[model samples]
Target: MILAIDAGNSRVKWGWHDGADWASIATVPLIEFAASSDHINPFSITHGDPERIVIANVAGEGAHQLLVNWTSIFDAEPLWLHGEAERCGVRSRYDRPEQLGPDRWAALVAARAVHTGPCLVVNAGTATTIDMLSGDGVFLGGAISPGIDLMRFVLHEHTGRLPLQEGSYRDAPRNTLDAIETGCRHAQAGAVERMHRAMGGNPLCIVSGGAARSLLELLRLPSRYIENLVLDGLARIALSERAVTR
Candidate 1:
């Protein structure tokens, strides 16, 4: 068994897979653990003694220590993943391959594992990232923007009059709430579409993350949503490492 963990800006998502398929998947609200004093075992969401525990943590030092403290109970010491020039059939074309976010790197690896053709990888969570992966397995760089909620929060935070509230999408928003929602959704979808166009080939857009459903409705391109993509990629990396060592 392999336990794959993706600690992002807002949440820590994990899954258990037995090489063939996923046994279970769950999320731990990262915000809840603001301090080490607020102890919550995120791993208790499911019971599994995984042979390997692989993680891609972009949540910073505090979260890292927390995870280490929790996962220490398991026999498998965590295998932390970092951005690399090449791994699991994906080559980085970024100016500084090591500086690329591990979440993005893992996503690219997972995209390559599932799709053979060119791809536009989009992960829309606290921030929306649109990455390009060539048919030949190259990480061709991409773009990042504030996610839907962050967009709304920024407006409310930076501007005094703009209120942060829920709203539905409309072709022409007549109210403030609708306008905010519509504009943010369009911005996310537009970034995805623009990256797809820039990639040129008839690439498949592999979308993931919390806000993906909203973008899915707005995007008119060839796109499909994959839940826990980072986790899947972490698992793939783990399996690859095991094979290499053997």
Candidate 2:
């Protein structure tokens, strides 16, 4: 079995593949990750030990320690994944490829494997990333902006009066909470729509991340939501690595 982990800013998603298909998949909320010792045991307890552990982590120092602890628990050293200049049929267009977030890079790699045409990959997790991939597998790059929650939080924390509000998406909202929520959603959707147009107006848009569903209905263009693009990418990278070694 192979353990594929995508540790983002807000959550840690994982998948177990028995060299064929996913045996199991799950996620751990990062809020409780620092405090919970038992959360990492489920995969091992239920599926036994993984032959290889791969991770694409962008959670910073505090969360990095949590992943380290997880590996220690299993006596396994994780194969930390990075965005390189080129790998797994995807070429980076970034000035410095390594600077691209591993999550975005992995998603692009996976997207190329499945998408044969132009595609815009939107990963709306802690941050909303809009990356464009050409039909032939060139990472043309996209946009990165504040996610819905972070947008609300920034307004509340940075400004003196705005409160942390909760509501739903609306084009014209009445309440303060709803207005804040709508604006955030609008910002996210707007960015996505803009990218879609920039990508010749009809690229295959693949949306992923926790807040994907919230923005799905608002997007002007149609999109397909696959909840685990990062994990899927990580799994593919793991497979490619093994093949190269053998």
lDDT values for all models: 0.89, 0.84
Report residue 67 deviation for candidate 1 (angstroms).
Answer: 0.9
Q: Model 2 residue 39 lDDT?
A: 62
lDDT of 2 at 68: 77
Residue ranges of candidate 1 with Cα displaced over 4 Å: 33-40, 44-48
Whole-model alpha-carbon lDDT for candidate 1: 0.89
lDDT of 1 by residue, 1-246 (tens): 888889999988888888888898887678865453535576755766788889999999988888888888799878888889999899998998989999999999999999989999999999999999999999989998999999999999999799999899999999999999999998999888888888896899999999999889999998889987898899899899878878
Q: Which candidate number maximizes lDDT?
A: 1
Which pairs clash in model 2? none
> How well is each residue in 1-246 modelled by candidate 2, as lDDT tens digits?
789888788987888988878988987787766677656454556777777788898988877777777666665568888879898889899998988888999999888877878899989988999999998889997899999999999999998887896887666888888888988998899899888887895798899988999989887676788878988888888889889879
Candidate 2: residue 26 Cα off by (Å):
1.7
Off by over 4 Å in 2: 38-43, 73-77
Instruction: TM-score for candidate 1, please give it.
Output: 0.95
